[model samples]
Target chain A: SQTIHQWPATLVQPVGSPLSLECTVEGTSNPNLYWYRQAAGRGLQLLFYSVGIGQISSEVPQNLSASRPQDRQFILSSKKLLLSDSGFYLCAWSPRAGATNEKLFFGSGTQLSVL
Target chain B: GESVGLHLPTLSVQEGDNSIINCAYSNSASDYFIWYKQESGKGPQFIIDIRSNMDKRQGQRVTVLLNKTVKHLSLQIAATQPGDSAVYFCAENIAQRGSNYKLTFGKGTLLTVNP
Candidate 1:
């Protein structure tokens, strides 16, 4: 079975501090990885997605960026976080078999509070 | 820009009763849909999915119905239980300008089960 891991579970950081969130998947290779953010009482907004290593597609223009260093390792990073960047961040993976990749498996999200 | 939306923001149902959640989508080009359940402080979990070729699909105790003509989607839970209490979201998948597929999610509907 495939599983995704994301961390840290919760974080409190200063407004100008750098941010790094890591996600990894086991039992699968060349999977599609995605990063999403959800605000309180709002829908998820897609941040980035990668189909393969060293390839990333950003959905929304923001201070955040994503990178897939390995086949199953993805990282979300920001040089300097802003107060508006606080939210619940989720990591998800899907099989790369064309249309069948519609179903996404998500990891327990990270709760980031920028103060 | 096209988006997905839910009919209601909250629903309360008695335990053992059936629960139905409705969603509306605006992008006709969307060919795939999925339903997700998110408990408080966790990521969205995949419940079920249906493609444009199928009107309905069933999983364990859940069912998803899609109506392309009316641009509506619904999720039905049988014999709702307390464990079923969560926020339900509907997502639609559309190709991003001939690139990889992207999902547009609806602001979730909060479902509370009363015992």
Candidate 2:
């Protein structure tokens, strides 16, 4: 069985501070990874996705970025965080084959509060 | 510019009753759909999915119905229980250029099953 792990279940960061959130998957290789953010009472917004190492695609212009350092390790980072960057960040993965219509498995998520 | 939207923001039902959640989408090019359940402070979990070629699919006690003619989708839960209380979201997969695809999610409907 495949499982995803996300760190820092809850985070409190000051404005203009650097941020890093890590996610990793086990039991799978070369899977598609994605990062999403959900604001309070709002729907999810896709931040970035990677089909392979060093192949990140941004869905929207934002203050954050994502990287795939290894086959199953993905990281979300920001050089300087803003108050508007506060939200619940999620990491998800899907099988690379026939990924266009595959369902995604998600991690527990990281709730970041920027004050 | 296309997006997914829900018909209701909240629903309350008695335990052991059936529950139905509705969603609407504006993108006709979407070929895949999914339903997800999210508890507070946790990531969304996949509940069910259906493709454009299929009108309905069933899993466990849940059913997903896709009406491509009206671009409407629905999720039905039989004998809803208190554990079924959560936010339900519908997502659509739109094919992008090349082999890329993107999922657009709806603002979730909060379901509360009373015991």
Regions more than 4 Å wrong, model 2:
B97-99
The residue pairs that clash in candidate 2, if any, are none
Per prediction, the TM-score for chain B is 0.95, 0.96
lDDT, residue A105, candidate 2? 89
What lDDT tens digits, residue by residue, belong to model 2 across residues A1-115? 9999999899999999999999999999889899999999888888999989999999999999999999999999999999999999999988885546888889999999999
Error of 1 at A115 (Å): 0.5
Worst 10 residues of 2 chain B by lDDT: B94-103
> Per-residue lDDT of B19-91 in model 2, one digit per residue for the tens?
9999999989899999999999899999999999999999999999999999999999999999999999999
lDDT of 1 at B44: 95
lDDT of each: 0.92, 0.93
- Compose the digit string of candidate 1's lDDT tens values, residues A1-115: 9999999999999999999999999998789899999999888998999989999999889999999989999999999999999999999998775555368899999999999
Measured with C-alpha atoms, the lDDT of residue A40 in candidate 2 is 93
TM-score of each: 0.95, 0.96
